[model samples]
Target: MLGRFRRKQGANTQTGVQEQDIGVSNSVEQQGEKPALHVHMPGFNHNGHKVTRGIKPDGESGRGGIHPWHFIRICFRSTSHISMIVNVLWPFVPAAIVIHFARPDLHLWNFILNYIAMVPTANLVGFAGQELARKLPKVFGILLETFLGGIVEIVLFMVLLHNDVNNNLVPVIRAAILGSILANLLLCLGFCFFAGGLLREEQEFDEVISEVGHGLLLMAGFGLLIPTAFYASLRGSIDDALLESKTLNISRITSVILLVAFFIYVYFQMRTHHGLYDSVLEKDEERDRDRHEDLKKAKLTLTECVFALALALTCVSLHAVFLVEEIDYIVTKRGVPDAFMGLILVPLVEKAAEHLTAVDEAWDNQMNFALAHILGATIQTALFNSSLVVIVGWGLDKAMDLNFEVFNIVILIMSIIVVGNFLRDQKSNYLEGSLCILIYVLIAIASWYYPNPAAGTSNTAEGAGTKAGG
Candidate 1:
């Protein structure tokens, strides 16, 4: 009996020990699980030792489950995205103001608002062009981007120049044409170089391509120079009507020549010497291979791209109508010279999208792509768009000429020279970029104070001439 009792006591002790081990295991598993719940539920304290009110043993946090601090952090992280949204939507504010006020006399307000509206629409064009280009060969893609990107400026000029038969805006259009070239060559290029240089000590691009682009730019400048020189020589000698007729003839001839040249350029870039522009293609292909899934996700169907392009162009065209209607009034009311409007404001509004793209490419150390974008835009504006404007003007019976003022001609020549020298080396740094930007700023300041000789005189003369001719 004594032995039996001893065994039984031992068994009882072993059973108690087993139960205690199981309890410890259960406690450890619970502890491990609590931290995961705390992570997803912000109401739970970090240590998992405390939970906020109304958060039961289940994993649900208190109402809404998002901490106030967490929401703030998210907003801070997405600040850039928010800025883009604001850029696209802010124009609506001015549009709303215009609707509320409904005052035609508020020309400056109207111009400012309409110009702001152009910016986001221009961005839409850029985005659509990018989408379309993705589905094309690299050389063709660049071409599409260049030509399509420039459509905004061309369309704006067409609408503005065509609206008034007397062509009072001839001087402004000339100034704007030269200004667009300068903005791309100096302002846009300068910013790109600056950004690229800041990101890296040095950046390199294709010298041959740069040289070719410079050659084309020089050609475009010469094309404009001939007409301006002809106008200057004839201005004092001939009567106003005869001089205008001679200028129109010269503009038409020059436009034809420029159109031909632009075609040749396109052929050269796209067919005869496509290899020059295809360096980026090989790298892009390799990248696409590595991130095939990513490329797939980003790709848009052809139909989608076309739809986007059409939609963007429609919006831009509508905005151009409003802008052209108010532009002259704005110039009159604000005492801002038409030359100044063309040189600074118009280009800024029209090319804002391309300007951003060049800077972005530069920041990524893709100097080739950056330089291509700048030069491509410069070429398109100078050769194709300028030529098209003249042709369109003639077709519309407005007879726009390429006769820029002496001040504008001088500025254009100087800008081309400065940029040519900078690009000759085929390499860039931050200092060079800073110098370009400084030069542009100085030019902008000079233009601001520069009086418009035609602004006061031409309006009266054009009115009288129209009456006499009629």
Candidate 2:
């Protein structure tokens, strides 16, 4: 009976062991078939390891994932930024080399280098102004941009007037001022109309704004004409000294009047008649909605904007210094008349970036903004910037008179008439644009051939001075 009991106990123990083994195998099989637990939190357990919720086992996110560094890398590789970087850097190389190694005798090289340098500097100023404008109200923003846009030309003229050893550059300066007016009225406006009209059949803007701007331009033209008329009347009778004194008096008075007029014009545009200037239609509004969002995205912080302006102004001022110092040498060496330089090259240098902006606005079919830009620039050049030059010249004892040449006066009057006709209806087409451009081209060509007998003698003296300094 004892033997039989022992055998039964052993059999019971074996059955129990078999049951335990089966349970272990089932548990292993169940674990192998089970899916992973995907927790949405950053830190989650997967099988015994902690993994980020969105990241895969290899530390990469699933499809459609974008890393911050990769995004930044892509932006830096974009075409526009790359081109801007190139523009900002390449010009400096020639400028630096010229500054270090060029001699006054190498006037051509100096002029080329200085001009190249000014291109980027001018662009920087435009960029800075645009950035600042983005932060202001529309009216104030436009005014600020106009002011900033004209600053370079003002500074250049001042430097030229201040450094005029023989009182010869006065004509050139006058021509430059006149050229700026013509450029805005004819070249810039014409191009804008052309670009906009090409894209669309016709473009329309606010007639009231156009009329007001045209009226202001007419007043400025008349104001300029006073000095010229006075000069013509007394040309044969007055002595040089007496004529100069009278001219100074007239310039100072005219400048004050222009300044007052400028303020009144600003008040009218910004405060009283603000609504007249905005010509946004429903379709335009819809288009600009997206643009507004883009602008918001691109907007700079206040501190950044200020810093950019400061930096750009510093660079532009430096370039202006280089340019002003070498202009006489350039004029002397190239045998090019100063009037031509002022009418063509100087204005081109000062207005290139601004011109690009006007063109772009027109191309985008923002005719109102484009027209405003052109007209505002024209008015600012005529009333504010040119007037400031006169006042500043008087303060500095520089003989800057508004006694423009007959050619300049005639051109100004003709421009007023042509532009008046065009803006009368506040409508523009490609044909009108073509006509304006044709006029500008003819004017430019005539200016290239225009003779200034006085320029030769002035250039000789300037060359002598340069040689002495060297």
Candidate 3:
């Protein structure tokens, strides 16, 4: 009954603030003249392909594509739309420098300051990267951004791997890897669904996007499971040292294959199946309909964006090092569980803020981009970031592998399964989204009590990792 009523009411249609833009003409439309941007932006040719044919804006189709105006347009997007805290977080960036230099002994303060500092710096890196991407071809720009999106996670992993020379930090790195995935799949995605559902009774997204993302995630999860299973099968049959050696060898081999797969998937997303991403095409059109859009233009130039990214990356790298340096102190001295620190606090600081864009997209009924953002970030973490850390561990002689603790492995695979089920219908509501958050809360509590692997334990992670690397 409700479905019928909704169908009659067109409830699935784009709603709110859009009706005013329909069936109306502005001064330019009154004269049957094109908007000023239509004159300069590239246009699509017949058959919906971007090309520049004569002065037709596009080859012959007379449709518009990205242009300089896009850069200007995105520049004006309010930070509030992306993150409420990014604006006020700048002070923490400089404070990180002060706290590190003046009172390095303050492990708690050092950790806290650098941790908070990650937010604004991540914003700058992402904002500038998007700004730069806009200057290139649309498909290539999307490709570049998609491939290079998670600079924070990459830097953090590098810092953690480089510091694990003593081989004690691999478990934290492993937990951090799964934690990042959990944050993306559950915490970030849940908020996107919930926040969007608050305004919309139900939200539907591009199913193709969700399907491809989840497929990749499942594949990556399977790859990780292979290592865990191998470790489990042999742990009881062989010497602990020999089992670690065999597991480490398989992990390195698997890491290489996963990296290859990651690139292949990127090619699939940005090239072969690019049209599947048409969900973004309607995005600007939706925003342009807003009454105040005429006043909007980007504030940064191409050079300015480049400069900002370089500076932002420098700060992000510094903060990551500072934050990682204190993990031992926090876990051992503060009596904080390593699992809790890695699984909850670290990911919350690094990813929880950066992902607000997904939530914003959900609010605006652009579920395709929102879902893509959520899943894409997770795919990168699970496949690319985790694999990179493992390979880098090889180079640095650290024993980083996919053989996470049995409990961490179970939670991660289960989280992916649960989230996949929620997304199977290609639709979401606030209630289902709230359930995701609840599950994450339960996991957080479990992580808090999850004991670190003690010395000479059977776990291949620290005591496990040390033996594994040997």
Which tens-of-lDDT digit does each residue in 1-470 have in candidate 2?
A: 99999999899999989898778767877888543444454353223334434333322122233344543332222112422553555457356446635575665666677677766666656665665574465667778877787878877887777777656566678889999988888888888889888878988776665788899999999998898777667765757557657866897899899989999999998898776554342234344423543332323334444555576566666666667777776666555665577787888878866776677677666677777778888898899888888888878877667877678788998999899999998789888889988998898888878766442132121222222122
Best candidate, TM-score = 3
- Which candidate has the highest lDDT of all? 3
lDDT of each: 0.71, 0.69, 0.74
TM-score for each candidate, following the candidate numbering? 0.75, 0.76, 0.80
Backbone clash pairs for candidate 1 read none
Higher-TM-score candidate among 2 and 3?
3
TM-score of 1: 0.75
How well does model 2 score by local distance difference test?
0.69
The stretch of ten residues in a row with the least summed lDDT in candidate 2 is 456-465
Q: How far is 304's C-alpha from truth in model 3 (Å)? A: 1.3
Please report how far candidate 3 places residue 297 from its true position, in Å.
3.7
Better of 1 and 3 by TM-score: 3
* lDDT, ranked from best to worst: 3, 1, 2
